[model samples]
Target: MLRYSAFSRDPAGGNPAGVVLDARGLDEREMLAVAAEVGFSETAFLVPADGGFDVRFFSPRAEVSFCGHATIASAVAHAERHGAGGLRYRTAAGDVDVVTARDEDGSWRATLTSVPPVVRDLAPQDLDALLAALRWSAQDLDPALPARTAYAGAWHPVVAVRSRQRLADLEHDVAALERLAAARGWTTVDLVWRQDATTFHARNPFPAGGVVEDPATGAAAAALGGYLRAGGHVPLPARLTVLQGEDLGRPSTLHVAVPADPAAGVAVTGAAVAMP
Candidate 1:
């Protein structure tokens, strides 16, 4: 297994992921064991398939349907060794297509096209429960953005706070949040503060995945793009930059592009660096 950090040029500045380049023979138990040993947020195991590869993501605690950072890290790692090109990833959520290219500065950037996204209203009870767990009042939320459940690859509650300080002061009941997430089939709670029309600050709580927070979550970024476009928060063909992990001292960036079509996949782009 190899270690790589996704969404940052520097290895220590992004979310770390374990990449098992060839995991043909490993079973579920062994994969879980390896993931636990690696102790990252998630690990990507690739098994060669006909068109591209079958990928499975395992967290330290359990298997998740999709993991954005691991996918980006794996694709960039693959590109570094094989060549920059398109890769079809067969994930549990769906078939995700990724393209990798080397920039002029010699950095490999990967863009993952998420599955068609969906945004739905947040149930009142669920929202109340979430607010209670975070010790946030309704006034702390952004009225323009509103609360909603978004799904691209994995489900996330996209909570837009009114202040960056509110987003930064992250204090939550981990067990309660984990229980709520597991019950709702949610992977993360995407807490965000819109800096401007095209820039945002985000922090993700991923207790269900056995992590306190995700430094850079491409899946949540894509979901946020879908939510913004669907709700007409941003204009069509919008390009937004999400700044994350600064509070944790592991800064990461996610570039999200939302097309005109609502049913189309959201594109998330970022760079990955091999970790020591």
Candidate 2:
């Protein structure tokens, strides 16, 4: 297993993920053991296949349908070992197309196109429960973006806050959220503040993954991009930036592109580096 941090070129920044470049012959039990031992937010297992590779993501506690940071880490590691190019990933959530290239600074960056995105309103009761669990009042919500659930690879409830302090205060009820996540199939509760027209600051509470907070969440970023596009909050064919992990001291930056075509997948780009 290889250790890498995604969404940042610095080894100490971004979210750390374990990448098993060649996971052939390893069963789910073994993979789970490896993931548990790695003790990162998530670990990725890559099995060589005919066309591309079959990928699986596993948190320490359980298997996840998709994990964006791990995908970026694995893809960049693969590119460094092999060559920078396109790689198809067959995941539980859906098939993802990833392209890798070297930046002008000679750092590897990977961009993954999510599956067709979906955005929908959150139920009132669910929203209330989420607010209660988060210790956030309805008044804390931003009027511009209504409460909603979004899905690109994994499902996350998008809750926009008006202030950055609201985004930073993330002391939440994990058990309550775990129950809610089980009930609603939610992977994370995305608390965000729109810094500007083209920039956003975000914090994600991932109860389902048994994590209090995720430094950089690729799937949630994609879902947020879909939410922004669906609600017409941002101009069409827009490029936005999400800044996260600041509260955790490991700042992560994610570049998101929302195309004019609604049917097209959202693109998320970030750099990854091997961790010592």
Candidate 3:
């Protein structure tokens, strides 16, 4: 298994992912075991399928339909060995297309186009439970960006806080959040603070995945981009940067682009570095 940190140029930053370039013979049990041994938030196992590849993601405790950091790390790993180009990944969520290229600084960056995103209003009861688990009152939320559940491969509840301080001081009941997430089939709670028109700060609590938080969440970022476009939160054809994991001391950055077409997939771009 190859180790990589996605969405950062440095190894110590970003979210770490384990990449298994070849897992042709491994069964589900074996893959889960390996992922557990790797002990990262998630691990990618690639098996050649139909001309592209069939990718599976496993967290330490369970299998997930999609994982953004693992996808980014796996794409970069493939590009480093097979040369930069487009690659198709058949994930449990859906077919995802990723493109990798070398940057001017000689670092490799990968861009993954998410599946068509969906944004839905959170039920009042569910929202109340979520806020209770998160220990965040309704008044702390941003009025402009209402609470909604966004889905792009994975489902995330996008909760936009009014102030950066509200986002920074994150303290949640993990067990309560996990129960709610599992009950609702949510992957993460995307806590965000908008910095400006093109900048934002985000924190993702991934209780269902068996992780407390994610340093960089591409799937949630994509979902948020789609939500912004669909809800007119951001202008069409907008490129936004999300800064995450800084509070965890492993800073990471995610670049998201939202197009005018509401049905189209959002684009998420970031660089990955091999971990030593």
Best of the candidates, lDDT = 1
Clashing pairs for model 3 are none
lDDT of 3 by residue, 1-276 (tens): 999999999999999999999999999999999999998999999999898899999999899998888999999999999999999999999999999999999999999999999999999999999999999899999999999999999999999999999999989999999999999999988999999998999999999878999999999999999889878998889999999999998999999989899889999999999999
Clashes of each: 0, 0, 0
Which residue pairs show backbone clashes in model 2?
Answer: none
* Residue lDDT tens for model 1, 1-276: 999999999998989999998999999999999999999999999998997999999999999999999999999999999999999999999999999999999999999999999999999999999999888999999999999999999999999999999998988989999999999999999999999999999999999879999999999999999999889999889999999999999999999999999889999999999998
Question: Which residue runs does candidate 1 get wrong by more than 4 Å?
Answer: none
Stretches off by above 4 angstroms in model 3 are: none
Better of 1 and 2 by lDDT: 1
Cα lDDT tens digits for candidate 2, 118-153: 999999999999999999999999999998999999
Can you tell me which runs of candidate 2 are displaced by over 4 Å? none
C-alpha TM-scores of all predictions: 0.99, 0.99, 0.99
* Residues forming the 10-long window of minimal summed lDDT in candidate 3: 226-235
Clashing pairs in 1: none
Relative to the true structure, candidate 2 reaches a TM of: 0.99
Question: What is each predicted model's overall lDDT from 0 to 1?
Answer: 0.95, 0.94, 0.94
